[model samples]
Target: MAKNSGRGRKSGGPSSRPTKPLWRRIVRSVFIWGAALGLLGAIFLATAVLFTMRELPSYSALKSSQNGQMIVVRARDGTELVSLGPSYGRWLSYDQIPQVMRDAMVTVEDRRFREHIGVDPIGMLRAVKVRFERGHFREGASTITQQLARNIFLNNSYSWTRKAREAVLALALERKFSKDQILELYLNKVYFGGGAYGIDAASRKFFGHPATGLTTPEAAIIAGLVKAPSNYSPTADMQAAIGRGNVVLGLMAKNGVISQDEADAIDLSQVKVAKEEGQNSVRYFTDWALPQLDLLLPETNEPIEVWTTLDPAMQKAATAAIDNNVPKGTQGALVSLDRDGGVLAMVGGTDYVSSNYNRATNAVRQPGSAWKLFVYMAALEAGYTPSDRVVDEPVTIDGWSPQNSGRSYAGEIDVRTAFAYSKNTIAAQLGNEVGFGTVASMARRFGITTAINTQPAMVLGTSEVRVIDMTRAFAEVSAGGTSVEPYGITKVTTTNGEVLYQHKSVQGQVLVPHYVAAGITDMLQTTVATGTGRAAQIGRPVAGKTGTTSSNKDGWFLGFSSGITTGVWMGRDDAKAVRGLSGGHAPARAFADYMKVAVAKRPVEEFDTKLQLPEWQLEPDDEQLQGDPDDYYYTDENGNLVHPGTGTQYDEQPRYDDGAVGPGPGPGIPQVPDYGQQNGAMPPPAANDDFLNRATGRGTAQDPGLRPGQGTGVVPRPSPSPVRTSGAY
Candidate 1:
């Protein structure tokens, strides 16, 4: 009876099995798989969403950095002379970019850039496919927003961990910044050709025009080169660039930016090759003023304009001086600052494009006789008169024999005459008379923060000092004894016009009286009138000094007018000597060329007469100096053992008087204990670590222990880690 209930099944068949409808079996299997998959998907979705929410940095809550934006310095004439960056990069606003250039960039780099939310799924899928097929990392799927996130917030590291971090950051960026704003930053900061970073620099390099003024064809050229700068460089390979330009045009056409007819009609053959030229920007000006920026603008991570005291005319003149007067193959640096410590102009090196090493602010080389200002100031403060007699004679101290390069001897002369003539023997004797420590102290007071060894030999400028420091010291002298810390920025404001930081002049007393500083000025003027600095003389009154280190390794000319102070240095990257060259030869000549062009444009002026010092009576010597309680005595520059309290005795003979003789024992110097001298034996000479911190008087002997920013310890983490938990599992 049960078997008959079913269709025409046999009795054995019905007892053996019961059959279900095909549709029902399919439905059951579908239900089971669907439920399992839905549960798995729900769990994965929840975990991914939660993890992302937890790890992602707050978009609106991201605390602005202390170094939020860069500060750009404009000269008095309204020319952009320099810029200081949070990380050596500049950020521009959306409106600052040309609309056409912006459009072209989007068209060539990402057609769907404006429509996506930081990432493009289609592009991502294609990238994944390409990567799989190539069996390696392939084309990027990151949109402009994603790139902005990676470049601005996350560090570049190729790892799943880093990629996850970038993804989180991309999400945050999309929430924080507007599409136009993100694209503006990306265009402004993207790497293009050579070492040039940013569309602005690339525009100037490839099209010989500013980003704002780029033409359609020129913009196409720049846009095309961005994909693979080295491969499609107009200067490196014109054929490759043309081919790339065609590709960009095709992409633009494909994106409906222009009709195919228009694209085909565009003259690819008319694309002019770009020439590779040295950077004409003011790289030196930026470097020389970096220290002042660190001091005055503690918080600089925001967009702001810095109105500087720079004279564009002076900058051009200084650059010309290096190019026109310096010998071929001679590399150098020059800096100019106002009496208020505002940098006016600078030439960091022969060419900023060829080398990024800034010699004006970073190079530390001996200044030779140029450092005599400090020595003489110490002598004058110690009660020595300019008319006092001193001898230029061969001498030795502490088993070290210093020799004058000129090699001839000059008899006793007045202090003023000795200095005017740059007599090494007289300088050494004066430095000895006053404690070498006194010289170092005087230099520090005037703002030379670099460590000057306390040894007597330092009088000849054995320690290395940067040109920027030298220029600032001279600015103090020009300001009539008030030391103004050199500064590059004036004000920093946010995009919404909130004042983040401002720099008022930093003032301090470095010299005792205007007379002391004036005396030094007058001495420097004499150097220009009839001494080594004669070449630096301008029709308007000027004062300066020339210097050459041993073996002619470094050359320098530093000077100042009533309103401006300048320092110029010339040498090789490896510190190799320039043959037959001295500060007076190329350095002074360069100064002269610059002054000739600069002085004509500036109003003629002299220092404030009100700051003039009153004439004072000269005393023979301090009789109050008492003998050392201990029996310790030391040899002076003349190799004569002197009692601790006894002043150095001057002889009438001088050393190496203007090459009349071969090198002789150098002028006498007092035996001052060397603070930097190694214990037991001399330690290895310190390597120049300018790259570590060339600016920010952060490591001067003033604080045997110092670092940038005030903190207990630990370098602060930059931004925040965007990497998070795996979403795949």
Candidate 2:
């Protein structure tokens, strides 16, 4: 039939049956491919994680190993001076931590720490969203557990592999340790600024106490340091640290760790950071002593304790002296030593935090008039007495004309009077007479290691010297002219009570003859009594000199008593001239300030005057006499020498006069004029008197009209008619 044939044709040809939609088919194919690709990606991620975990350090290995200990320094009396090491301080237990500190840490570092299972997925997602919105990563989403994991067993690296390891390691740590144990390890392993490691050390470094006693605000401040130790350090940046602390407090309040009222009640102004442990105000002294450690201990792996000669009271006094007397923008250094050359106090600069130049031991500067002490020592050794008369008239040495600071010269004056006035011309002539080589040799004997020029100008302190050596040189004079090798460490002991080294008291050899020492001491005493160093009088038998160089670039005062020797230097590091500054102004004041406190506990002892007169003065003969009897010596109403003499009465006592000229000088000798009536060329007596009165705590009130000859009593006659007598000596 036709129908059967049509069916057969239709069956043999393409038949139109119900077909599926293109969209459904496409959807089915995509589903199958996506499932297979996702399975491959998961396998790849699993393989990467397994490889990263293999590189992770063992938990037991990291937990067992401990860092190195500290090297502690102590004062002679057992007061702690400082500690030096990589990881220093005590390790605290979990129960010992303050609740406030825990709250602060949790609030700032991880609010969901208690709820998270090691890694906080929700927090990470939020952080990722924020980073996506910002187009860059600016915030961290590490939970406390993750942080602890990273700190303990992982290095800080920015890679997906590292992140995967951190996450896996955090999970492992969470499973192996309790929450409290994790927190304890984290607190003990964190690094704070200033070489402080762990929360306990950080607490002691910033608060001077243990972590258990931390207040809420203090806890907040410490917690803030976790972000950036140096950037948030209270010692380095207090304002920024406080700002961060306030942020922590805000977070704590938001997290309900503390009430809003409690958070608001915190007074940031009342917060005070403890002095940093290793780098306190005594860093100068410690730095100077550090190099000596090698010579002291030699070899030691155990924690050692060095007993130094540093006096805490004297250090405080020295710091106060510089802080109160020296002006801002100017630098100063002070060094105090015992008569036997033991360092008591050392201040290298105005602020140790600002700079660590160690000006006391490292800075080399000109001594100015202070160097005259060595020159005079040479002169004394060359058979010249302090009472010997030297012409103060204009003189030239090798075509170099030396002039007085005031530009007005005294005609003829004894060595004692000329030295007291810091007469430059007299010093130059004396240096030439004694031969600069002799003076330089004497300086070396006194422990001056700096290069010395043999020029006549060296007598006026043109050569530079270190303050430590200068102080040691003065210490020799204080020790009755014995050479002193300055030493700081008295003993060294290990923490286990084993003695490493004990200092032996080595008596320095007698360098200067007894008579020479006594004569120099007497002249220097006169200098403090009525000379340029009158500003350094400490109400005791103090002897010192005032040094002022050209353009006032450097100023110094090196002085001492029977007990202690001190030297002070004030100047600009750049060598810029300081206007109106003189050694008699600030340096002398600082010396007196420090000495007053240094000797407060010690008994006042008088210098030896048994050999007051040198052998030359005692054995004076007709050959040593050059002037008339009345011209050289005149008796006062009380039987005191009015001009110059070598008797004990003139030894330690300052001569005083009522501005009266006794009689006209001999022929060709200039009559001393009343310096009270002079003008610009005359030095201001009020400046000198005010400094003396303020420094010594004596003398009458400041009087501008007071003349140099009016109060001091030792008057060198001015050249009679201002003659230009220029001739080489």
Candidate 3:
């Protein structure tokens, strides 16, 4: 009505259109604001994607970074022992992938794998909703392609940044590679646990075969490892892995990869995880050989296979021997070497899971009478035959006297007899006769690596030694005096069948004369036949020596039988003593138990040469003869016959037809503790320090060593860290 003159326009006022409904105006305003916000969000998301892509590695770098191969260690029998570093199986094309494996991977990992373009919005939204409700990031919707990209191009870190990068890389991979190619790469590079990185290696590792031969259930089992490798690996836990495999089978049925009946019929419980060398026992050998491998080859990233000389069966036997024989509170170690010095078995401790200290190769302790081996070896090399006669009375060095145990001396006995009896006095006399310098040098020449103390007491093994060194020394003797250096690796090759390194055996130099070695073997035979090492007998020819330290701190039995030199040691890690423990009791028995299984595969072998030592026989008139058990008579300190365990003495002496003087042969024989009887049952713990020092004239500022045939109490210096070089010290 106001538009009468100016064409319906109001002058001096705002112009306006016809008024619309309030609801329509409100909807229009809301639409305009929503459009602006949506544009802002789109721009922000594009900037974030670009930021994540800034650090993205090139797709070609994916295969290049994984170019480095795994280091596989195998036993002598070609059984896999362990794998070091990223391990992958042979790369397979899409066609080579078993249908079961492909379906199992797809159905269980990503239900919409065929439909998604790198990232699935539905799966991500569902996963996000579930995670938000749960308040913890547990459920994941990562596809196979996403996992492949994550493993190749990124670390397994849980962060928004990592997720952004993984998503960007997945999109890039999807854009470049075909679905089949992407699936092939994913299956070939995914980690399936057990130190394996891919389906093929995991297949061979868990099933001892190739992926081509994987059964449906086996494929399901392996596919299940993708989600949680350490928890689902058959080698880690069989029951858990089987349960996971069953879950996969259910998914396979739901996806129609397998019929429900087929999935139900699959017995994953029958899945026998390949029984490879995963025992903690083999860790000892692998630990020792790892350093050796480094020395043999220049460090590189290329995959290498190390073929070692370890006998898996023998390793099991050795571990069992230590676990069964070593006392509960104490520790034990054993090192066995072949005739060529190849390490066959090594057990550092009873349980590697409990304690990984490699006692066989690392621990440094007194050799006790085991050092007498070098002393006697020095004597034998210094022109003394085993048959040579030596007085078994007190022998002094720096005013230190070596006496027989319990002061029961076998006077003027032959060297063979004294050695068989492990007479402390005789050992010291020989050490005195043959300069201690020569004895220390003999130990060095025989492969004792620890620094040797050249003092007079060194002959009694005052210096510390390693079980591997002792075993190496014994291996030389077992090899008929040829020099030996303990070795394990035999060949190094790549998975591609290219030989990287092969051992070329060097001719061994003679460490001792053949006849001298034979002479030592002669006395060693006597020791095992009638001496302190009688318990180490394996019902066949064996030569060994028994060693017991002061206060029963350590026990040792070093021997060679059937071309294998094995050394056994039993003691505490902290150098504490085990009461009533002796070399002849536990250590020797352990030696026998191990050797029985160790030599079972080899033919019975006898020492080819024997020294023409005199036959030791107790003379009829001599007092060394074994008396009848009925003839035991209690004797007073003054040599008068008395009742058993009582001081009451009888002056009257009985006569015999043989005309024995001191005590009659029948009922008047003196009852004395038999210290030299087969070295059996760890004759009640040795006397205290004062009595032993007075008896052996020991106890000097520099000499903490015990008498020979008795354990040494030398304080062990802090041991040097184990050197892994192949060179001898």
Candidate 4:
């Protein structure tokens, strides 16, 4: 049909015009499609740009509303100690930022920050090539403006659409703000970790100074955190931060931001990280206090201030004392309390960085001889005077007989004397005479919250107890027998100074009888003056008691000086023995050192010296009773001495140094035959006769030579076994 029209040679016929080459047609079609796609892409990009610009805030609003909530902790004196959430310092201007910091940031983050209009094609292409070669995406090519855009508006989710949005926002930011403003915004808005936001906050938090005076290495370190705040933050990983800082220095030198020699001259070690108040030892206090916020304040994420009773200076001294006195590989914890039970200082471990177990409040360990306080209190409550004499001879209660530290004893000692010397035999005798239930009751009344095993061994502090509880008990005695509920937060308020909670220092209800408290205090004073706690003497009218567990697994010194009471514990985390580490030595020394600082500001206040009791004289010497020197004449339920017949009669026990095992259920304390050795001398010790090595603890707390529920002796594990009310303590 078209051939018929060829007679007229139609101008528009495809055959009238020679057909175009196939390749040319293909090229033309491609050009048309590319043009249409380019138009659509342009429109799509403009739409994305508009969408990204929708929710952006003005610079003023951004600055004012960035950090939402923060919990700041302060000392009693209103000194800022630490904060929990995002914390910002004063906003710094572009001129205020150190030039080294600016240079470091630019060289490491974006070399073409000034030349590019928010994004650099060369950098993008180079990053793409590297990523393609590596077969994975890597973080790079983000200009400073792009970073600022992301920090201000976008979250940390990665995607193609996210990249497009970031580029659009970056371009918009560059158009909206000058280069200096963009950089200032970037530095001020970026997260630098450690609860710090902005360069100023980061500088103050890490270096303990303002950003205006940062050193080259310090500046580089701070700037390097922009890529990954937690990774490069000095407080988080100083080594990684340092390495990245070195890389930044090298880059700065190569990019002419700094001279090569200048870069080399800087060493990250010279950059001292400014220590927070109390050298971060207060972190223990904050860790202890933050959880209590829910109980103390109204439920809200709103920022608040916890005005704790923490004595920053005392905290620093306490941590230093532990670090200096605690032997290497062993751990020590200390906590100080005021008369009202305000935690003035708390150190959970020798190094908070290495171990954060919080031994002060959380760890439940054996209190050793320190448990004698409650036994003496029970005796006093039962109408026994401190002057009442008791024989410190080996006594057996229900097949369990614990000896003194060195398997030695001091006989015919008074109550106060026994307490001062931490005589396990006398303590057991008194505990047995008063009824073990009464002794456990007395411990409960005195604030020993942990389970008291109440076995005959419990008389020697075989039960587990926390250091804080022990300190609280002593605090009660220091408060003239008033109850002491351990407290740290004195008041809580909003950042604007509106008080949310105000602690009223109410006089606590009497927890112990007046005579009982006085008696215990008297014994404590005598202990520090002449007994095992003599090492705790701080040149003040301080009173304290010492405690050492079997094989010296745990050593503790709980004391009160001036208006402050402190308890210290030294032990291994594994509950293993530390030879020769007794409460009278390292723990007592730690208590003295910490107390020296804890009570430095307070006036020396002496404990009650007057004691009321019906005094009695000792029985006249009897040669028949002197047959077996190792024999013990225990007091009956009525506080009457029960002498034995056949001249198995008990005499005054021989003296022993403080290393022998005490009288208790503490394992590894060997059982000896009753009445065989001449001159009342003990037979030579058998193997594992040192301490109760055969004693076993429950719940993974095994003694060095002991197992759970096996051989007799003090166990390190806490047990809920019923109190043997009928047995002798």
Q: Which candidate ranks first by TM-score, i.e. highest?
A: 2
Give lDDT: candidate 3, residue 425: 74
RMSD of each: 21.2, 20.4, 20.7, 17.6
List, in order, the clash count of every candidate structure. 14, 0, 3, 27
Q: Name the regions of candidate 4 deviating beyond 4 angstroms.
A: 1-68, 87-279, 612-729
Each prediction's TM-score against the native?
0.53, 0.56, 0.52, 0.54
Q: How far is candidate 3 from the true structure (C-alpha RMSD, Å)?
A: 20.7
Superposed model 1: Cα runs more than 4 Å off: 1-73, 80-278, 287-306, 492-502, 601-729
lDDT tens readout by residue for model 3, 355-459? 556899999999888888888888877656665557776656787866565788766666777777788877877887778888988999998889998877777
Q: Rate the local accuracy (lDDT) of all candidates.
A: 0.67, 0.77, 0.77, 0.77
Judge candidate 3 at residue 123 and give its lDDT.
92
Better of 2 and 4 by TM-score: 2
Off by over 4 Å in 2: 1-59, 62-64, 88-279, 610-728
Which candidate, 1 or 3, would have the higher TM-score against the true structure?
1
Q: Give me the displacement of residue 610 in model 2, in angstroms.
A: 4.2
Which parts of model 3 have CA positions greater than 4 angstroms off? 1-56, 59-69, 87-279, 612-729
